[model samples]
Target: MAIKKKRQPKTLAAGRPPVFHPRPKSISRKSTKSLINQHHLLEKRKRQAIAKGDKAAETAIEAEIEELGGIERYQQASLQGQRHDRGGDSSKTLMEWFKPCFAEGQAAPDRPLRMLEVGALSTQNVCSKSGHFEIERIDLNSQEEGILQQDFMARPLPRDDTERFDVISLSLVLNFVPDPRERGNMLLRTTQFLCGPERHSSTWSLRDFFPSLFLVLPAPCVANSRYMDEDRLIAIMESLGYAKAASKTTHRLVYYLWRRESKCLGPESPFPKKEIRSGSSRNNFAVVLG
Candidate 1:
């Protein structure tokens, strides 16, 4: 009898995300949920001040962050929050939403798809090992080998369909772009880097199909924002020619898959910062297009 070889399961990545790199011996286990949230809020305020040309406020916030161990320390803390052991890997959910397409035979492994992962935190996530996707990962501050240090806003737009992606993953990225108008512009930019429906056999007509967006936002941005709710978000995406295909919400995050149903916003599309809802406890998070 011939010996049989075992095959590896495709669902899990061959390798796992490593612990935070260059982690100082004295700084081990130094990050907490509250600390991470503080860093996020502080960074957002810094960005807002810089964007508004408020030099004094920007200087003050920079001094405060620097006093609190600087941006590098905050970045390391954020990475700790993303450790696989902490249930911080958002791409796992993206893979779950994608698997059915391959299972149903709509996508083939031989014809591997392309994806752009913005604000990527790891090189060994499940999507990178799927053997069905050629992923291009980028971040503003890349601390790993595979992810490039590049700003998504400054990345050269695809010259043609061959240069565009079948999918785009914008996980936990938009919230960091402090200005609401710029946040809206970033969403508009993704449409340009996506391969349109005509290139694929499946139109964004079906759920979990290619030419789609996997958007992950902090749940509070939708749930507790005075200006935003799930309904308002759906409406904004509609104006940009995408239709919500699926959604899920947890106490910490809100995830959605939006299919590119039509062309994106033109030069003059208008989505202003008008209050749509009111609540005393809500934070101000709005995506404005001007």
Candidate 2:
């Protein structure tokens, strides 16, 4: 009889799991108690590592915590808690607040008022159906037809001052700028696109109110929202020669319509003679969008 073939055992390497794999859905569905305990344990270990001056251990622990989905889960829970804490309908749209401003300008429709919507690529139809205003849409990162792919912060104003719009909409744009100073720059740049401060000789009429800014921003205290508060925002606008025409709030956003003051009464007014500078280095109060 032939000798039996030698039997071989499977090697561990042959049975090894895949090196790269997607995280399991079970991790996301983990029980609240389990998630909390895991977070606490990681925090305790991190603290211990810090106390022992083990930088490598601390970094590794941090990475482990992140990989375990601890941080993301906590952030989601915190946001939910915040929403429940602030009891108001969070589903309201920016257009609702903008409608009143639009309605006010309807009385003088002899000329089609110009309106510029910055960051309009995402929300294309905001003014598409409106007969009261002609809209010019501009955006920084969209390839869709009709969207002007220009960065609002870097581009120069039109050669003809008349090309400036009567109203400009900044729906859900300001919060992107993490710096307060840069946010101010975004507002100042908007003024260049809007009708400038009324000359001393112009008579008061509905047209005086034609050019206003419809702005929407996240609530200052909202979870994971921008750091700037509504009070500070209004203050910044006022300092930049805008007076708040109207304001409203949903659960998470604060919307305001700011009109250019007939005259900037503040000592720091940029409209009197100073050019609104986009470079932060050139001017201390500069608001650069880039």
Candidate 3:
């Protein structure tokens, strides 16, 4: 046993211990500082890209930050506050008040009440929300994108099918048509389309058209592109066999609620007369003599 003695491992120069080796603390500190500097450089570059309006570069940075799970922090730092105000006298407004009254008594729920809108953009949202009707819009130009595809004056209505609608809303449409006769014809045609041939035994007549109609027109007194006085419009409607039930005129627009009648009741028509009422906040008017 005493023939050979084993040798121990070589120790450090300090001779403090053989197992321990002190790390280069400066290297570790330098590496951590490098990482922090790299992060700051990246954020600065992203800001510069955005400031320069380089969309692609900005997108790339956003994507990289998102992948690194820093999207929420980026959004919080970049986003700004927006302000909105929803306060006013809503009741006194004409269209705002008229909508609820029309939706009161109706039949179909599943299949929306079909409406033909003329000279206006797709009134689907307006009609559906206010009157609860599905709008089939027809304008002068091909403007309304999806709802219906056609111009009112340019093309004749498709009469091959017998499908009909419950309501027809001609809002701010007739004024655009220059010819009063054509306007009258358009009004009559609208009624004919809504009341399909199958519904009646005899040929379509203006007297037996729409039971109820909403006509929103501009005042003739106003000097605008499409403005007609109340008397002239009433005469035209009367000629087309529409007896006005209610009418109201504001500063810009005139609204008429008409119904088709069986027979003409002498020359003296029942179209409502306009009455103006002044309000402190806003002017109010009523149609009393229909």
TM-score of each: 0.82, 0.53, 0.44
Taken over the whole model, the C-alpha lDDT of each candidate is 0.80, 0.58, 0.48
Ranking by TM-score: 1, 2, 3
In candidate 3 the C-alpha lDDT for residue 154 amounts to 60
Q: After superposition, how far is residue 172 of candidate 3 from its true place, in Å?
A: 1.9
Better of 2 and 3 by lDDT: 2
Among all candidates shown, the one with the greatest TM-score? 1
Candidate 3 lDDT by residue in tens digits, 1-290: 56776878766755665566774232233343344334435655787798799999988877766554363332222111000111111112334534443444632233444556654443334344565555666644444365455666565655643356644677655544433344545666665555432332232331233344677754532223222345555675675556776676665456666765533322354434333323343322122223
Q: What TM-score number comes out for model 1?
A: 0.82
Residue 257 of model 3, lDDT score: 68
How high is the lDDT of residue 23 in model 3?
Answer: 45
lDDT of 1 at 286: 93
Candidate 1: where is the Cα deviation over 4 Å? 1-31, 51-57, 104-110, 202-208, 267-269
Predicted structure with the largest lDDT when compared to the true one: 1
Q: After TM-score superposition, what is the CA distance of residue 178 in candidate 3 from its true location, in Å? A: 2.4
For model 1, residues 1-290, the per-residue Cα lDDT tens digits are 99999987765454666556774533344445556667778888988898799999999998888877776676676667667666657888888887777665453433568999998888888888787788999988888899999999999988987789888999888987877998999999999998776565443323346688999998999988988888888888888878887788987889998878777654346778878778688889999976
Q: How high is the lDDT of residue 266 in model 3?
A: 26
